[model samples]
Target: MLPLIDGKVVDITGPGRTDRFGVTCTDLGASIIAPNGKLVSVFGDTFSGRRVGQGDWRSPVVLIGMGDANHEIVYEYAGGSDPAYARQLWDYIHDDAASGWRRGGISTVIPSDLLRVGGSLYLHAIVNHGFGDVIWTEIWRSDDSGVSWTHLGEQAKFPADLHDGFAQCWSWDFDPDDGWVYVVATGFQRDKGIILMRVRPDQIGQRSQYSSWGFTDGRWQWGQQATPITPPDEHWGELTLRRTAPGKWVLGGFLASSYALGYRVVSSPVANMYTTPVQTPIVGSSGSQVAQLYGGYLLPGSRFGVTGGVGVVVSQWRTDTGWPYRAMQFKAKLKDTSKTPRTPDPVNL
Candidate 1:
């Protein structure tokens, strides 16, 4: 991984309409180490340096992955002119004569997290736009450090029939401890709400079928069955996991709703699969990236949590009493996750 100077703001322009898929900072004040033992740093590009939601143009989707300590992988998904963007990425990571890598579908594979397991590097991508409109969680692997790819296929069950809409899955992570991968997704069969599912690494590149929904509404509560954490209904995007203390893993992200947008936290038994999620106050939005610190640890002496990506704060519009918290600039006091309470106590003290 490249060592970016602390507090250094670099500009990378000229990538026609860039859509940043995710951002991750490695060094979390010594909690999580960078990919290769070096301190982790920030590496993300905006559309011509414009803020995330300000520009009218759609940016290129970028996903960051770690492959060993020396190399940081940045994967982009562009379904325009190139047509073979995914294939190009495959070629870049693998050698020739390779029959297409293992992937679920072909439209858009925007990876949420890139992980290395048992000498092979696997990518967790949210299949946004494909031949079918449905969205899905897809996995792609490279045994030789971004050399040749073996499209392991969709990380979830392959439907009997393909749908048109994107298979909008929230986010996913891998658990080395249990050897399983967990994902949170919404079934298009329904209008709204989310359904979470758990899969294994061996299930990659292969297809499975599910008769009914994978999760229930009460499943996201804290200290209940299925990992025992209650996730907020706010627009909580994808999830990323890391080991903070011994045998303890924390899930981080922003809970985005029509009323409020802020960071969230939950502890889990397995590494990436989140069964139950308890909401915390690390409130704020991180655009495409959630509340994950790249190195996979919280900040040193930092009571509050650290949020990545285009940090934007919106007021809570929907509450029990219908009180609205207007969107505001959170640049100054954003990192104060320590001050946040376990429940929805947005007193702003």
Candidate 2:
């Protein structure tokens, strides 16, 4: 198995576009590579101009741009009425009347992660009951890239108590090799361990079709009750488990306990993450370049094997002053320590 030995930060993405995008005070950039070869990104809790009346402060908006917009996050306003601003996914979900928080009634239905399956884009979003409390999660889809969406509805909605709430937040990828969508999920608010699950791409809307990996009877079982892939060593926040290509995987996210973005080069979902070490390439700090870091979404150009490196999109929010709350891109240099190459599992998740 190819394990990441070490890594380094490459650069911040979008240049001045963080300011140019007009949506300041945003966090959690969950993205996917669209069929048109564009990097379609979604952000949570956005603020543009005002906070009420559908003018500004939109929760969960979409931004379409080139994956390699290292120079500037050039945008295409194909999803919004305004030809100049990024597209806000939901207009009905506006700021509350009193505190003006929770862009959708008492809570913001925020985007957790995004994935492209077949010709459509699917997004996993959390419905909140309060701070650190999730009521449920639903998957939404869009056929015309990020322009619009249709929710999978009540039948497909995942309850917050599902798997003891570990299924509240998710990051997933489609594996064409076996036609299964491998999912790695955790609780919101960074309070739980990671769990691995798999569902067919077509059956993603059906909760009964999902199967989880757990260590039971002294061996790994694909259809067993869900178990944390990582021991309760630390609290994990907003995770990203992506297959850069088939059979190639890298998993990481906000390590809430350490206040840093950490990752592991996982060979597979069932490849024993309990013992594998996590590498922290970017550390969060108050005086350093990155502060209050979270949301480690792997961009399109990220590589998995040798010549390893990941261009990840990370979010920074200054708790003291929320002005610097935005998403930036950083490349992590990877070190491989594999003595011999590994092959894909003939039988799958």
Candidate 3:
């Protein structure tokens, strides 16, 4: 785990607009280890414009983690402050009109989550028609560890309205016990509950191989009509589910109903979620220092097994100001018990 000091959530893109990472501002720093064994983080809605989300607007930019100071993330080729030299995984939809960020026209493809199977990295990204309205989601492959990519084609494409539009946003982790990829999906609009699905590792490219889990015939079984696994009236956004340790899983994200970011621990992918209460270590405030907090993707160094400090990247955006539209690293102190809150407010970091 990367050592975290103080409760301060430091910015990863240097000092923001003029940072040294060659990235001015970015959100959704979903970290994943690249095929080359280097730490990698994928960002959404990256802008190198003189202002936030303005100039050089690009969707889905990936960075190579150099260590955390270590807050530095460089481009795949090389990194610097110049936006023109910035390299992206693909040139699918890049617009730099400064005011041409129209949803339908620009085709803003936001990365939902990433997974590395064997020697390949698969990226699941959503194509947006407009805010909360997804056109479709596609799976892209990179055998050279993100240096290049190949669209897996219609065989791997998932409809935006799959599961009644609840399957647009995804978070997945491979389960070696059954050699299946366990995935939990919610609406990209942040307006729906969650459901579970599993696909054999080798059949990831075939949409037919993906089976939904549900409470059918009085037993939790796959291949049934997908049912909501979340509590009644609970809606989630931008969640991540990872096996932080052997047999131990951590799941949670932006809890839309409560307007806070929290996490819950479970023993297996099929664990009952209602009983495992949400622990909100970080709460969002309208104008607090950590204002407009949303993303709660677990960082690489998080240790959920023994109970200590867990590192995660949380994003903050000033909807009014546009800057501070970046992801920052934070460390939370937690004990083994899941009863309630802990230590003090600083531990709530």
Candidate 4:
């Protein structure tokens, strides 16, 4: 299922202030695709390292994944506050993969999407407190892989019958046919475009077992509530939604008024997400003439066995000069019209 060819942008974090690892600009740079395939990125504020116009807001929180044996682990968040004023968890190590990554020893959890399943690892976080008030999304459970974590507090919220305030929890996967674990949230002022829940990889931390994904009358039910499988003009922001092969699935994100980086493969993520997808253009959109994209993660080994190429790990918001939120790496190629024919909208549930 590797097809995505639009290839060219390769900068894998660097230039946001000479970058070496002190990431600049900041944004939810979630990524995951390890287990030997490599590509673990995770970021959300590194502006203190300076370079996006000089730096001063030290709210460090970065990690690059793959430690313990495969080596190459670059963690950060050495207790400088801002996990909502310190939830404790410090680890700042940097062996010079570029003078920019540190923070690897302590973590109260801030990762967003890390999946492992069977042997257990799962992260998919958000539990905030650092200035945004107190966001939610939570779900942490390590068996020993990520060292230690157990907070399984809030798994899915913000469905106040369909929306009333906040929600966060973007990107998730683990649908071996139907075993569950779908996720892909939105709301928190995103206007409302994406939604779909699932849960059952052993009750993913049990939020009453999780369900959502309803539509009524036209069909496609589940528990009968959640909607917008992405259509309200599609304003989703930092997304990922996996499953690239057995029935395809895709999703990808960043379309807040055409800021570019779009995608939508669908064969079933509950099918029909309003078709008409496949739009690149990052680096600040306007058709990405180059320079201003933002977190478009898609690497999980590109999904299904080798077939063409498809890596994605975008976030080039450097804005003015040379380093602001750097972390680029592209290798697209899946455009044979992406296969076309997606029809399935009337499920009998």
Best model per TM-score:
3
- Name model 1 segments beyond 4 Å from true: 1-107, 128-132, 135-137, 153-167, 186-194, 209-232, 258-261, 269-349
The ten-residue window of minimal lDDT in model 1 covers 23-32
Find the candidate with the highest lDDT and give its number.
3
lDDT of 3 by residue, 292-318 (tens): 888888765565433236666778888
Give the alpha carbon lDDT tens digit for every residue of 1-349 in model 4.
2224454444544443224344544545565544434334555545545455355333224343432211222343221233222222234232222334234322222445667666565666554433222345556665644434566655433232333332464678887877887887774344557778787898877777778887878776788677777666667667787786777777766776677777776666776666546555333223555457656777655532232255666666655664546655565544533457655444641
Q: Write the per-residue lDDT of candidate 1 for residues 151-253, one digit (tens) a residue.
A: 6644343442322221343344556766665554433322333334555666555544311222245323322222212333433433334333334444443
Model 3 gets an lDDT of 0.71
Go through the candidates in order and give each one's C-alpha lDDT. Answer: 0.32, 0.70, 0.71, 0.54
Error in Å for residue 237 of model 1:
2.8
What is the TM-score of each predicted model, taking all chains together?
0.45, 0.84, 0.85, 0.33
Clashes in predicted model 2: 0
**Local accuracy of candidate 2 as per-residue lDDT tens digits, 46-160:** 7764222223666677878765412224555434554456556755554344655645554677888888888899989887755677778889888887778888777679989
Please identify model 4 stretches exceeding 4 Å from their true place: 1-24, 29-45, 52-92, 97-179, 182-199, 203-239, 242-250, 253-260, 265-277, 281-294, 297-314, 317-322, 326-349
Tell how far residue 295 is off in model 4, in angstroms.
1.3
lDDT of 4: 0.54
Question: How should the candidates be ordered by lDDT, best one leading?
Answer: 3, 2, 4, 1
Steric overlap count per candidate: 57, 0, 2, 34
TM-score of 1: 0.45
